[model samples]
Target: MPTLLTVDIGGTNCRFARFSIEKGALTLAGTARRQTADIPDTQALMDACAEALIAPGEADALVIGMAGPIAGQRRARLTNAPLELDLSDAETRYGVGACLLVNDFLAEACACLTPIGAGAFPVLGPRDAATGDGTIGIIGAGTGLGTASLVRDSRGAWLPLPAEGGHAAFPFTGKEEADFQAFAASALGLSYLRGDDVLTGRGLCLLHAFLTGERREAAEVAAQGLSRETETLRWYARFYGRACRDWALSTLCTGGLFITGGIARRNPLVMRCASFRESFYDSPQRSLLERLPVRRYADEASGLWGSAWLAARLIGALPA
Candidate 1:
């Protein structure tokens, strides 16, 4: 059996898992978590993540999926968090035979390639829409917006394309939107707002504040089953749809769009809301947008599983 230690680092929390593969099937040995805010130091936090999954020298491979752009494949710092990781010495210092690092959404894309992927997410649009062919686009919003795409190669092998699309500027048109943009700019102290900042859980809080003139946490807003008239959820849904629309068009996805994250997955009402459909289909190329099937990855531990799956592949335990 091939043993692996995997880590999924997001803005809010860190998930650690120990996986063993046999006969190409993944078995979860154990799992653990630590809040990102609780990380007192970089070295200590890394050690804690490693030991939580497996003892030193026990893991054949260590794989990590992080919520930021990967640098030279093994170096990255979280976009919304303060932790910076340089895993250049992991193979020796961490006692793992190898270390693999990738953008968190790239791991999310790879998860949809596995059997668990097939049984995990539910389609949100027309059942007949997704043919499960051609290129697939993945986007999700939680603490931050994450994006990636999966494409088939000449060998028919699926290859993952990672992106920093979330960091790109998000557009706001019309007077109402312009007003909110100005307010957000003032609130966030950023003249130029990125998609990651505006289409995220934090963004939902901002929307709530703008609508009600009251500040609330993201969880509070998500939990309150407020009506459509509230406008907070309506605008959030609209922004999410816009993000999805841009990614689908940029990737030119024929397979369909896979949406995942704590936002739409935990509270599916956002995807079903009329505002989402309207904004998504509002593009000048409306027909093209309508043709794209949509699905949402629902598993909360999706990134952890994705990291383990990619780890197995990187270590030659599973087919690439």
Candidate 2:
């Protein structure tokens, strides 16, 4: 069985997992997590996590999936954190023969292949007939909004496509919501409100403050929940549903739409709220959305598993 190391780097913490094939199935051998702030550099980040999971030079390849746009698939600077990676020295520095760098959401897309399956993640919608052979959409909200897709080709292989759709303009409906959007834009000192600021933790804080006038952290607002009682989470759910609907429309995701992120996992009430369901199915093209499946990968380590999946295939991509 080929062995490799896979990493999932986020704005706060980095997750490392070692993978091996057992009876033709990819298996996670060991895993570890380290804070980005604690690791001194990229080398240290790799060394510490690798040491935690495996012995030196035991890996055949290395794969990294993190929060950043990859340039030439060899280098990147994380958008939400101070970490930067240069994979040119990966073979010599990490003692791995094959290496790859990719967007975190791409890794999420990879996870859709083997890691997600029957009862693997929660189906947030009423129906789930996802055979996962069509174009799949993946989106999430954490330190920032993340979006990606796994499009199935005529050859029936799912290819991960990265996108920065999170930075695009956020939609606000009605005069009340539009006023809040203006307020958010003004508060953040931006000309237009973007999804990065609308559907995340900061968005929760801003929404709470606008309604209650008593500013509190996102954690506080989340504790109130998205039930009929809590206005903050209801509005947040509305914004979130809009994001899902728009993404589904754009991608025309017939396979399935998977949601991954801390916000929903930490506050599942938002996903269960009536407002969320209403807004999600409120579009003119609601029939298209109704046919699509919606699921949630609640495990935070999904990216790590996804990275391992890619690392397993890295050997085939290496030059003969």
> What's the TM-score of every candidate structure?
0.93, 0.93
TM-score of 1: 0.93
lDDT comparing candidate 1 with the true structure:
0.81
Model 2 lDDT tens row, 14-105: 88888887776778788888887776567786677656787425788788897889998889888887888887777777676788999999
Best by lDDT: 1
- RMSD (CA, Å), each prediction: 2.0, 2.5
Q: Which residue pairs collide in model 2, if any? A: none
Model 1, 143-200: lDDT tens digits are 9999999998988777899998898999887999888888888899997788887878
lDDT of 2 at 304: 78
Query: Candidate 2 has what TM-score?
Result: 0.93
